[model samples]
Target: MRTAKFWMGTLLAGALALGYGCGSDANKDPTPQDVPQQQVPDAGADAGVVLTLTDAQIARVLQVANEGEVMLGQYAAPLATDQAVIDFNNQMVTEHTAVKQRLDALLAAEGITPEDSPLSLQLQAEVQQLMDVLQGPNAPAAGAALDLALLSAQLNAHARTAFIGDSLLTPQATNTALQQELASERQAVQTHINEASDLQSVIVLPPVEP
Candidate 1:
């Protein structure tokens, strides 16, 4: 049962030590040595192909997911006036929190700890930018204005989450349990994206006073 502080400290230390964001290697394809074998589960034609991931990749995925959960939860805390927005925010908070907890437990069980990667660092920067926008003087004063900002941010965040869960993490996952988790993560992110889009459509911004 490693504490959250421990996990954060370890991940940040690793990120700094490795200089994760220093190079452009983040976009490089996984080398032959780095690639994990795929396992085809028997479920007929509808069964999707399952891929394998290295332990390092798994750690990276967990780190990104954990940081995302923390950032979204923080951003959602201050914008709870509208019941609809509040409900959506609550759902995201609950889902992402559970994701982080589950990933943490998996890492602990495997005697592994998460380390930071370029993607995680990128997500951190994005979260900070969004926070600054929300908290700055220019931030909207509640109502539809606030809801639009929040939903827009959530849309972008969940889009990235979906991409990472599907393109970056899912294909590289080796463990059956982890693969299942990633699948669920992808679905959840897509759901968030749809919800955010719907909210954005219905929000009626107040008109400017001439």
Candidate 2:
């Protein structure tokens, strides 16, 4: 449950920050952008992969990506003591949540209920295992490490997701919210990766100039 708090707290803090920072727009379009049109996936990748995803497929993808991104943001939020890292984490959470909202609107237009991804469901299971570990003696450092890794993966995962969403949903005419969200996410992840890289350095002394 404490682990759960880690995830939820990140989301809550991020939303609060977003709401206070710029104020989310429920009605405004994400903004106009030049996203490439959707393309069909590789035919050789999988036998059962559908070429043209239904509206349902789109919705499911959005739902999982949003929730996962939030969880990822939450996981990353407290991992860094640096201000940049914290800001980046907050940016990721805010953007993804906005994406989730946009996707939700699209889904409701079709009267759909989004389902969690099998991949995310598996992650949740792993989270459960992590929670078990956190409850025991491995709670402190192990838990902290777990959040770091998860958020790192989230940044990468979100990149792929952005590509996939652009391809599948064809967000050519995004509103101000979606556009800003995309920009924020792209920037946040890049910043987060840099910060994480700095933190992970071995701290070797500089080589003497020959």
Candidate that scores best on TM-score: 1
Q: What is the lDDT of candidate 1?
A: 0.56
Clash pairs, candidate 2, are 29-175, 29-176, 30-175, 30-176, 30-177, 30-178, 31-175, 31-176
Worst 10 residues of 2 by lDDT: 29-38
Q: List model 1 lDDT by residue over 1-210, tens digit each.
A: 211111322222332222212223321222222111112123444234333446555666666755665576567656746677778877777777887878778777776656655445555666676666667677666766676666555655665566556555777767777777677677776666666655555554323569
Candidate 1: regions farther than 4 A off: 1-54, 204-210
C-alpha local distance difference test of each model: 0.56, 0.43
In candidate 1, where is summed lDDT lowest over 10 consecutive residues? 32-41
| RMSD to native, candidate 1 | 14.9
lDDT of 2 by residue, 1-210 (tens): 011111322222332232222212311221111011112223343444323433444456556656766765676577645454566567768876876777577556656655544323433443344334333453334333443333334434444454444433345323444445445544544454444334322111223679
Candidate 2 Cα outliers beyond 4 Å, as residue runs:
1-52, 115-151, 166-210
Query: Model 2: how far is 154 from its true place, Å?
Result: 3.4
Residue 189 deviation, candidate 2, in Å?
A: 9.0
